[model samples]
Target: MNRFKKFMIFGALSVTLLSGLAACGKSEAEEKKSSKNADGTYEETITIDVFDGLANYMGVQEGWFAKIVKDKFNMELNIIAPNVAGNGETLYQTRTAAGDLGDLIIVDKGQQYNELVQAGLLYDMTKYYPGMKNMARFDEAVQKMNEGTDALYGFPTSVSSIPATSPSEGLEPTFGAYLRWDLYGTQNYPKVDTLEDLLPVIKSMQDENPTNESGKKIYGFSLFSDWDGNMLNAGKQLTTYYGYDESGFVLAKADGSDYQSILDSDSEYIRALKFYFEAKQMGLVDPESTTQNYDTLYAKFQDGQVLFSWWPWLGQAAFNTQTNLNAGKGYMMVPIEDQKIFSYGAEVYGGKQFIGIGSNAEDPERLADFIDWLYSPEGVLANSSQTSGSSGPEGLTWEMKDGEPVLTDFGKKALLDGDANMPSEYGGGTYKDGVSALNINTVLPIDENPENGFSYSYTLWESYQRDNTNPVLEDWSSHMDGAVTTMEYLEKNNQLLVAPGASYVAPEDSAEISTLRNQVKSTIVEYSWKMIFSKDNSEFETLLNEMQKTADGLGYQTVLEFDMENAKAQNEQRVAVSK
Candidate 1:
């Protein structure tokens, strides 16, 4: 059956269910007449099923925000939450398959969206997104969401950026190097500038001063088996000064046009693999890193057994609150030297959590209007504010203070006071306060500040010690820089190899491509991990050559070409938009 037809059938079933439930309490006729209308607008009650994770912070439908939407939009919202075992991805897929998709859907998973787009179940919002033209005033990343496949499909919410300065100066920290300052004081722990510098610290912690009660020497660092860990390790292996050429197909650029794949080439992959092996051999990396998940690693940190680990800054707050580790005494971020700390900007694709009309939306226009309201200035304020009653969800705005909208006490406390160093009981601040100004990142007008003040303002200067004076580059320049750097670095630095990209292919691709990509990725990761953790250092050259042969057979050349073309097209499009 067609998606539209299936959606209509589901809508009918929902209407019938509502009627039946209403009839149990009232006469059938009364149930039928419950909806009121005036001037062609549905006075009739309508319910929109929304699949969301808002419950984590906002609680259930009983919240004040829920009441506001109902009262203002004249509609009821039914939210379906996934079970612990089933994340939003599983629930969304199941609902879509059952033809029971919600009127509005908020997808947090990037891979899932790729699948849904292929399934032809999602509404192509290109026709419905005039509301977003205003959003062009926001970051270019936000604008790009509207241009996927040359058609707009979604709206991206605003997110904050990391400050130009480090929370501590004289420390050259990179992504994932979470230095435990509480244990390693500034004097004892000098700033680490290179991977080589990290080794000595790790060795000192391991042999000189083992802190864990179990008598196991605390490793200077820990690595994870998951994708996040992989990214961190990869980033560390290739410092941010030389980032991946996400736009260029070249591992090394030959002339202005010639490109090569680092994976298919010999030197880069081997060097990256060798570094991992050396770290593992030196006992700097967790022996169980390949098996342990984040929670397990976090537990180690909480026990004060770890002096340093790799994770986002937020980990500090989360760890302090959940663990018994003396928040003040056991941990703080360490300073690294000469390293350009590179945290991922909030602007990446698939990071934008979007709410959109689904296949089952009977009143799409109404749904669109509601969404517009949510993204509108007042709506943004309302949705973000804290509510009133204890039983009710706090309004998005807690209360207006001095003409400014003070976030809920929780929000205010989280934003203003929450610091990595602060104990969790003290309410580590929210990401809101640390985020960049909304006017800088969102399409909203800068002049239109909330009467109270900009609630979304970021303390970039207060937070970090770096030079924030560089003019913001145009989106295209930044994008190209990323691509070119990755490509050129791979080509020139034969020893530095990136993990094969084919491993992350979305599930929607043809089975043949998926199988090939998976095999290539699996081989690289397996061999790379083995090399890093091997007890007997086997010849690295032979293994790397074998991996390259496998990648070549898997169509590495084709993949590189495709990447180049895609990058060029995307860059051109971005440039055109700017003009």
Candidate 2:
């Protein structure tokens, strides 16, 4: 699977794994459960085995960062994570079904979440509602979680209620369409209002500059099947062009119609697919995109083989100052007409990551308090950066200056190394591949902070300076002229970032619906490649028909009617909760 896909499956579990809780049954689970502390602190250590290697990186038993978590909360956290990455579906399916789930539960959205809900694996969050510290303030996320049920079951992470952009900030477009600005500038900046317009522009750039500095051939675009979970791939993923789908199920509202399968000929997803087919014909789409995993795909980005990116962060390693600032190499494109969503998030619960107290958690109150702590200003700051101010390792990693958190050069060096001073137990590089949000801390709010927007989040909380470099986007933006960052563009267009149609659907499990949904997913995954890599438009057309036929036979229409019914019902809840 691709890195993105792998993350979607394992990231949540990696953060929520409880080797401790998983070992216990109902009897043992109660014994280990924590009790509420009168002083809002615990005197014992809490073990979290989210990491495969167990959180050995920090000698949390004695590490300065550990000391901070302990000192602040009066509790010690023993974190654990994997030393490598892998798909976690089997592990979860086996453990959750066995009723030895864990002390905490964190999972991504999809059929799995629904299954867990149906299986009664989740803790009903009704009793805690709107009362967990700053949680009520994150209303969108709260409402999103409230969907499909009268009670909330999970909390989302990495959400920003306000724009998280700043002067010269890197454009983190939620829509996967992005381009290398350096090449676009070389062609004198053409006006591109449609997907077709992006064609020759990328072609000319690839033709003009055939290879990168590393002697690798450069291509106009790249795709990955790894992120194609549930049998999805680039073709259907482009449905983010419409908005996030709970399943790969798509609905296009632009043509004065209700939600329907994106597999339809007129769907924006198909149009984007056709665009790729044509781009492939021009030798502009990277062939490796089909074969490479995320690590390899990311290496290509760093190597400069891929000129454009579907996701914003995928292109970051190649985004040094020389290219982005000196040569003006990259920028996000404005949303297209058929493309309507500003962002595809869990809205609150299921977009990126989610958290819930384990059904077997020993102390539900303690876990709730712990979760509440995570939403506080202090917890947000800690999860954001490696270590800072009182949360980090003092002179060794960070220091306070005039009450402001700063990463010292020495500390930056350790952080960049990732395993520096990671107590002997940490034993290897800090828990697996370099992906954001998977940490010793389970189900954390990586995007939380005590700041306003980019102005606050960027300058202080989200600064890029590990030690030497600082504000990659800020520096690059200084050299940029009249650049329209993602936030600016969205506001200018009066776009609304709303919950996806699926999110509005009831969370209740429907066996028939799920069966049909998986069948549709399989069809899309199998045939999307055939259509995109077709030798001719006729072949693409032929493949499209085959997919539609398979979908229809599989009861795709009935699924849609069911979806519409549920969506209308859920939409009412969505509107009511949003208010």
Summarize candidate 2's per-residue lDDT along 1-579 as a digit string, tens digits: 011233443322221333433334233343454455676667655654232221213222334434455565555443322222344445565566566455566555444455555555566666656468666667676666547765566676544443321111223444446666656667876666666877888899899999988788999887877556444456654555555433335453422235655666886667768888999999998887777766677677766677777656456434433334434344344345445543433232323346666656555666666677666655554443332111333343455565555656644444433324443332323311211232423222334344422212322333433322334334333433433355455545544354431233344336576667667766877788778789998999999899888888988787767766655555554455345
Largest lDDT belongs to which candidate?
Answer: 2
User: How far does residue 307 in candidate 1 sit from its true spot (Å)?
Assistant: 3.5
Query: Best TM-score goes to which candidate?
Result: 2
Q: Cα lDDT for residue 390, model 1? A: 10
lDDT of the candidates, in the order given = 0.41, 0.52
- Candidate 2, which segments miss by more than 4 Å at Cα? 1-27, 32-46, 51-88, 108-172, 237-248, 252-258, 317-341, 344-353, 361-370, 385-456, 459-484, 493-505, 567-579
Model 2, TM vs. native = 0.71
State every prediction's TM-score relative to the real structure. Answer: 0.58, 0.71
